[model samples]
Target chain A: DAGVTQSPTHLIKTRGQQVTLRCSPKSGHDTVSWYQQALGQGPQFIFQYYEEEERQRGNFPDRFSGHQFPNYSSELNVNALLLGDSALYLCASSFGVIRLGQFFGPGTRLTVL
Target chain B: AQTVTQSQPEMSVQEAETVTLSCTYDTSESDYYLFWYKQPPSRQMILVIRQEAYKQQNATENRFSVNFQKAAKSFSLKISDSQLGDAAMYFCAYRRRNAGGTSYGKLTFGQGTILTVHP
Candidate 1:
């Protein structure tokens, strides 16, 4: 079975620029969560999507937003990016909202120059 | 709000030895789940093991096991018979068991511990 997949192996952006990352959940999964992992640190929750709507969010700024598509794929958008926004972006998927296990994808490495 | 902490930033062990990574969490909710994830240089986060809060018995999987102290809010991962493949950055994560109404599955993660295995 296919696992979670993310687009753009790596990305580079300057300060105040906008960037978007995409993620496709596992073939049989529907829920998708996004995380941001800074260098030498663990992944921080960004937001989660299900049923083509945002289910919950973390303590992130308004500039950070996300969307869930009808196909169970998701996208994370960041506006007015700061240098600190550079990190590895991970997408996790599960079969249901209350599922116990979450499978993660190969994260997209973001570098803010 | 839930917070997970990993005090050890770096640790090393012999290939055949064992090592433990410490993790502590604070949460008011009684129903929740704890997880240990391994992220190698490839950057793919893999679940090592998980423990349910209500389950008194500590969760174990193969050579990977957890010492879960519910009262102290402590969860540590012990990797026995460590191999070179076990060398990676380990993360401790927490998720609340939402009963209903937007039961989003978001994980609260610790800072992380880097494990280095030497031959």
Candidate 2:
């Protein structure tokens, strides 16, 4: 069975531009969560989606949003990207509960130039 | 607010040796979970081991184990018989245990510690 998969292994954008990163959850999983990992730092929670609706969010601003499809895949969209927005975007999927732990993807490296 | 802290920014050890990575967290909630995740150059976060705050027994996973001290709010991971493959960034994370079990699934992570294993 495949684990979580993310598209666009790398991305380059400019300030004020928008970028969308995609992710497909592992088979048999229904929830998807996104994280941002700045250079040399651990991953920070962005938001989580279950049943196609956002169930929880982090301290991020409105410029960062996400969507979850019926298939359980997810998209993280960052608008008005700043140089600080450049980071590794990770996608994780879990079962119904958080205790099950989360399985993460390889993550997409975003560089805002 | 919950916060996880990994004081060691980097550590080095020889293969076949044991190395312990330190982690400490602060949370007002009594019931929660602590985790150690390994992120290799591949950038995939791999679950090393996890400990539930309510459980007094330290969790053990093969060559990996955790020392979870509830009162001290400390959770440390020890890697035994370390291998070159163990060289990577290790992260400490905390997740609040919601009574509903469905809400607040987000994880708060600490700054990672880069581990270097020598042959």
Candidate 3:
């Protein structure tokens, strides 16, 4: 009964560099979604992965991409990052696509210099 | 475009007291869901309570309850007998109902209200 887990509790990167954050969804869950929470702000939706393919995306640019493995784990990659990219990256998992309630992970704090 | 707003940026209540955090949203879609998530200092987002737009009865979880007004587009969370553990950043989020096709599960969130429970 493990909840959603994310790797690299914290990361530091410079502008124009790329970084990848990992997440393992809770057991019995198949859908994974990513979000970004800036300081003093709520999380903004990044994208969602289902069945190894991207199902939906938010207002993010092409630099932000994600992948879902067969085991339902996910990776969020940000390329050519900017200082504004520094934020808390959160991963959420749910049982299905239609499910509204999602279990969130502890999140990876990314710092872009 | 859907938008959620939490006017109260910070609030405090004495321990064992009651406090209500306000949230309002604007959406054209009639069917949707609203949620209240609690993020503690540890930064883990915990679901506090949720309400379905179609359900007239308010959703309640233990000491946490929501006052959902569909017409007014308001969703407020009321915490009774608040505890020190209740001190956290409370976020209000909204999601549209999945009719068909690709379900993104996208959630639009508000600015969040930081609740402080004074002991």
| TM-score, B chain alone, candidates in order | 0.96, 0.97, 0.96
**Deviation in angstroms for A67 in model 3?**
0.5
Per-residue lDDT tens digits of candidate 2, residues A1-113?
99999999999999999999999999999989999999998888999999999999998999999999989899999999999999999999988667768889999999999
Question: TM-score of every model?
Answer: 0.96, 0.97, 0.97
Ranking by lDDT: 3, 2, 1
Candidate 3 deviant stretches above 4 angstroms: A97-100, B100-103
**C-alpha RMSD over true interface residues, model 3:** 2.3
Q: Rate the local accuracy (lDDT) of all candidates.
A: 0.91, 0.92, 0.93
Superior candidate under lDDT, 1 versus 3: 3
lDDT of 3 by residue, A35-93 (tens): 99999999999999989999889999999999999999999999999999999999999
Best by DockQ: 2
User: Which 10 consecutive positions of candidate 3 chain A have the poorest summed lDDT?
Assistant: A94-103
User: Poorest 10 consecutive residues of model 1 chain B by lDDT?
Assistant: B97-106
DockQ of each: 0.64, 0.70, 0.62
Task: Using DockQ, rank the candidates from best to worst.
Answer: 2, 1, 3
B12-64 per-residue lDDT for model 3 (tens digits):
99999999999999999999989999999999999989898889999989999
Measured with DockQ on alpha carbons, how good is candidate 3?
Answer: 0.62
